[model samples]
Target: MTNQGTRQRFSPYITFSREEWRHLRDSTPLPLTEAELEQLRGINERVSMDEVADIYLPLSRLLNLYVAATQNLYQATNTFLGHLEAKVPYIIGIAGSVAVGKSTTARIIQALLARWPNHPKVDLVTTDGFLYPNRVLEERGLMKRKGFPESYDVRRLIQFVADVKSGKPEVLAPVYSHLTYDIVPGEFIRIRQPDIMILEGLNVLQTNPDGGRKRAPQVFVSDFFDFSIYVDAKEEHIKRWYVERFQTLRETAFRDEKSYFRRYADLTAEEAERTALSIWEEINAVNLRENIAPTRNRAHLILEKAEDHTVRQVLLRKL
Candidate 1:
């Protein structure tokens, strides 16, 4: 295989057997209680309280440390320059394949980190909001590539992150509606300079420098990130997760009258299964291979999941 192919296939110091992963999971502390687990029952059933306590709890604790260290570093830099400047928000980027449990990771991290004493204000944003409106995509003949990099308003996304990192007064991100399968007009989530921002998406770590005789500018979404995480799992496992989530939605979210996917609400189980598989193959899998998976090494930490959606092993980038 070529060098590119080899990197695509594997990463050194980032692989683990299932059993070893289980030992790690077993050794991790569980910070969430049974009552809290019950609270998260419906929204994210795939990841249990045990999963949060064992995997995400520890991860949140580590992030707290990183945030504190960053604050001190910024303060020292300011003191050396003899200028008083407020600390910038610590930005985190989370990347993963479709249905690889990244949204859950983002949400879980948001909740956990908010509970941390040091970082009281934690904001979570998904790149879904950064996607162009469906009308724009349809006008450009890119409706089918909705989750691909080209489907996004990349310039707007970059600007939003840059503004946030720059400590702008307030930055508002467009809100996306899964029900309408489009960006909501005039609806946004405002971030008021939080202590930390968790930005989650498929290709948050992917970067492509401007190609020119003069290096125009090298800015990718990850350029603004203080740290990043890539959620990793076998392709087959992710495919199964996609299908399973589809099935779940068919019974729940798809049934909502306001849901854009309401048309699929009446699909029989077998029909739904087939439709799910087709969508995964055509849209998600292609994006995963072409855009998302290649950026794994760029993350500061990697969470590898198993077929059942449990975090099997974690790979921490060596300091």
Candidate 2:
């Protein structure tokens, strides 16, 4: 079954099966090879070539058409106003719960969109960089809520996207290190002018937090997006994925002495499984229920996945 509200008969989205979506690809050649697919796939996630051909090829083609249409509309509007307005980057937002394969989806889309002739300068950025530094979280007593919306520098993140949307020549985003589980000091990722930009995160689809007060000016990160995608799966499936990924990391990244989770590397298999479950139950699951899942309906498209991490169905919101 699909997520809540998706089951409504009068829903705005048109659901499509995997086979139906695959048929829409037509003659679009798969631009990525097996090696590239391996590089893009996330830990404990399975994204095969067939999966890409069936799901992403058509998505990239659809996005290409949207980009072309948007450019034409921009030109027409400029002509009507008798002014040559500057072209800004087309922004796409990708949101999903942790361990739901959002990173892989964003990376694959970035690769495919960049290969398109119209937008060869596609750039991808994750909201991880916008997260408040560890020191700030600790000071605020929000270390346990690291991935929560309150843990982010929302104003700065919004401003960065606003600058890019306003056709700024260059914008810089802070750098985040997963191994250290913190932001790197004085490090930033520079994004030059590009035809397309993909912003990926767990909270990208969330609305303003004004408690419905209509104040002077309220803007959300998603306001600048031309399109948005939400990767979804059953809560049970996601919990299992998270535990599995945690175990895998314990054997690999957690073994690094400098890694933030180095202590987990010494856990026995049984102990590791129990610890992983406890972390998910106490932290990740709470965040998903209270913050992330509520915003799923805000996406223009929803890719629902199965237990195996394969996208089982596609739901495209009607225009």
Candidate 3:
């Protein structure tokens, strides 16, 4: 579409500005405390409770409300249809760029929503578990494009989610290790009946490759989400975050003897900077541009953040 046509269809996309964007950062009646936030702090320092309460607490509340509304709607439907059966799991998706604090957001929301009396037994599963084993990626010469849509076993992922949403008795998802950056062998996480399931990862919203009858089933992962959130920030800010996270890992996680990235643990400051930027430029940036960013419109809500990693504005899809 031409710029004029695009403008006519998506006026909201072009209207947000730093000066005009304002949402007060305040706590809820029952907010996540500093101790609670500390439990969620990942290997990186970017995620904290203030970030959660200011940004993700509101998001979690919104998701809870959405799930409740969905339940009410389903009950009304059941009454009209004259059938009685328990509803399926409510799925929530979260997408964001690498080093944009997506994992932290997922963990925080999972913890908070579990505390909600209405939606207990909330389980968090990541699409990283759907990634093809390293051997497969190497065989396909796709190791460099690990985060690309093609690198995942999309069929298995879609099937697992479809089964869960269809009220399947049990669904087993593969386990992935951050240290090795690959699927662990002989290990799978079993998700039983749960009130809510939070699916988190990069490229979770990408479309399937096969376009056939059995292959091209329903919508992708984003379709299963009762509510979806995409963390947003300037590209420069994300780049800085990537560099900072890499530095932290060098001093911490990478130092683990069993880590696959252990070789990088001894990298000098200069060498580490070069290595981080190289990976970002070659792999992460390409995947973000070609795969992830395009799915921004598929989200139910967008939390736009500033350079200092604070949410500055929120773009919500009008229902």
Candidate 4:
């Protein structure tokens, strides 16, 4: 815990309570209806309309201003260069532990930012697509370590982000499937030029990921980000949410024929719960403590969540 003492510094972050942060919304209207929000919520993640109006609306408004300012800086640089060039998209990176509702956060932020008139085309991309396929992981004996830093194709992920940030007219990213638990071969998500791009993943802020067969890349993913957010919650809260989600998936996705976890479909309530806890304790919790949680302060902003999954405090890095 001494490292945590070293890592947790008060000087960089200006902390705001939920009430104080929500007031910063400054009349920004809630963008999504109840149905849309419900659709966006992750398994076992409770996000209400009030969460949006209070937490996300203010966050979206801040992002809009940042994007506009970035766009202006781009124009100014172009003017100084004496030639007009295509402007690149503003990249926002979201990092968090598993079952902390990162995908929901990314989707909600994408929807809200796209609704802003200035930036109508906002794209959301996850680093899941950059993960190595099950075949490769099996070859490397990494099936149990899937979410760890070494399990990713870090070089390819870096190249993809570099291309996007460089304003490549069209870029392709590999597709990943949660149900099958593998990269979908020959399937890709094509990203056209967008006003903003949100990149969400567990380890986006990782500066140096080691212990793989391949050497670590020289570049960090956060280097290309205009701004970044880390979704923070207690480890116990995340583990509980993960187990609950696993149980929910046991009843739903696991029942599908194509699910990688189809064997779990017939598990009794006790068996399912026990299995979920074992996986979390053995795998996810280790990764969170060793790889993910340490990168929290690297974010431009940190959303500290309560046990109930509500934003209790917002920590914006001091400029």
Candidate 5:
């Protein structure tokens, strides 16, 4: 083959099937029990012990190694400068479409990585907290675009990530409530200096050259991340998951009087499914295609999921 033709077909990622990736688990042990995992998994996600052992265990071992190496480099830099520098937390960004289980992945990875002796403290912050309040979104006529990049208080979100990455002693992230579907008034999640931080959201890996505000920095959130992961699956599967989760929530959170989706609580099974599918097609799917999926290749690693919510392939970007 001609050199030019050969180069055209080159793939930058090393793809591994479930079994191939499972073997990479090596001596890593599963630290969480069945009960603990029950708490970690999402409403519609099918995360099991086998999934953890085959997928996350190996991934966590890899992340542990990355964190350790990064720490060593930080120390090395300080040594060369002949001065002590504050240890910065290793930030990990997990991005994917809504209802694609990125949140669950982030939690799993956080739980796994925290058990490692070297990096015992792991913090998780989701971008939902950075989304504009309902009133603000309404003012901007962006209620339908809640998960879109433009619906975020981008400046504040960037500042939060910057502050955390700068080793700030205390940082407060606004709390977002699923039931209320808004940023909780005056509520916040306090984050101390952690060994590692996992920031999960749809747009963590996305970059906007001109942000919504005049003073917003052009810096991407992934810029501060030492590593990034994109949880991926076929759109059809994700749509099904979304519809299923919405139906489940109707029986649970939507029944709460305070829920933003309380009106949906009375929907029939068919009506609920139709509504959820409509939402997927209108808002979430559009966001995924335009802003989120485009950034998948930006991730250092991508976890491709099967229809049953199992991770079928792990694609690690070649160095």
Candidate 6:
């Protein structure tokens, strides 16, 4: 791995190599065990205890500090205004291309942050719930662009985040099933007032297309975030990971009778690889290039990963 100085300087972030970032973990003890990691890890993703100690521990510690600082600021503002204000949940947005391991990062951060003494009530919601139902997508001719921003009910998603940020006691969000690859009708996940909420998705950092130029309602999903992270990797590496995950799922989840991708389970290895590559090139790659990657610089932090699925560097946006 190259040192930070050797990397091209382009963004406003201060880059830290893996070793340099790992040193920031300090004395924070790992609260998670191997069994817990197995449960948190996504299919075809590798997350070891060492990786958590090196990468996520420092991240959780930094978030803890940020949460404390934000709370103090809120209290100070209330004091200056001479009025008591309700505490709102600290919202974090995690964005990345599919197979870049943002989901795993979100879950790990949720677990780690929850273990902290200051905030034990942490909730995670993926924007998958914000995706239009499969029938709706089909009706709108957006089935092929399922992960694109247009396939999501952006208004509803923004409303949910707004309500949460407004200190609502309880909020309901639609539930999505990976097995069915669609929203589950009549099902919703209820989140009560949590100390922290992690919203993870490919398009969480997306803004309005017009950039709020046309003075209509101009709320974006990212406006509610107190902090945001983008998990990043080279397109070629992410494409390989996507194909690998597809093959793994074909052998596992896709084999289920009720699985939406059951048809893929019976394909020969060569056919499966070809199909996965085609899907990557046609759908995932296009979305990453046109929609997802563009939001990487919008994140407060960027976790750049190596081909092995391990984060190799940390990029913290300069204050």
lDDT of 1 by residue, 163-272 (tens): 99999879999999888898999999999999999999887886742212234346888999998999999999888878888999999999999998999999999999
- State each model's C-alpha RMSD to the native: 4.5, 2.9, 3.9, 3.0, 2.5, 2.7
Model 5: residues >4 Å from true position, as ranges?
1-9, 209-217
Q: Give the local distance difference test score of model 1.
A: 0.82
Summarize candidate 4's per-residue lDDT along 232-311 as a digit string, tens digits: 99999988898889899999999999999999999998999999999999999999999999999899999999999999
lDDT of 3 by residue, 1-319 (tens): 9997787477544333333332332344445678878888665546655566556666667777787888788889889999976558999889999988788878888988887777888989999998899999999898997878888888798889888898787889999999888999999999897999989988777675331224555667667777887887888888888988899899999999989899999999889999999999999988788778888888877778788777777777776
TM-score attained by model 3: 0.88
lDDT values of the candidates? 0.82, 0.91, 0.80, 0.92, 0.91, 0.92
Clashing pairs in 2: none
What value of lDDT does candidate 2 attain over all alpha carbons?
0.91
lDDT of 2 by residue, 1-319 (tens): 5665456557879888899999989899999999999999999888999999999999999999999999889889999999987668999999999999999999999999999888899989999999999999999898998888888888899999999898888899999999999999999989897999999998998774322343523789999999999999999999999989999999999999999999999999889999999989898999898889999999999999999999999999998
Candidate 1, backbone clash total: 1
Q: Candidate 6, TM-score vs. the true structure?
A: 0.94
Candidate 1 TM-score, true structure as reference: 0.87
Candidate 6 residue 75 Cα shift, in angstroms, is 1.9
Worst 10 residues of 6 by lDDT: 208-217
Model 5 clash pairs? none
lDDT string for model 6 (108-186, tens) is 9999999998889999999999999999999989899898888888889999999999998889999999999999999
Off by over 4 Å in 6: 1-10, 209-217
What TM-score goes with each of the models?
0.87, 0.94, 0.88, 0.95, 0.95, 0.94
Residue 141 CA displacement from its true place in model 1, Å: 0.8
Q: State the lDDT of candidate 5 residue by residue for 137-183, as single tens digits.
A: 99989899888988888778889989999999999999999988999
Q: Where does model 3 exceed 4 Å of error? A: 1-27, 208-218
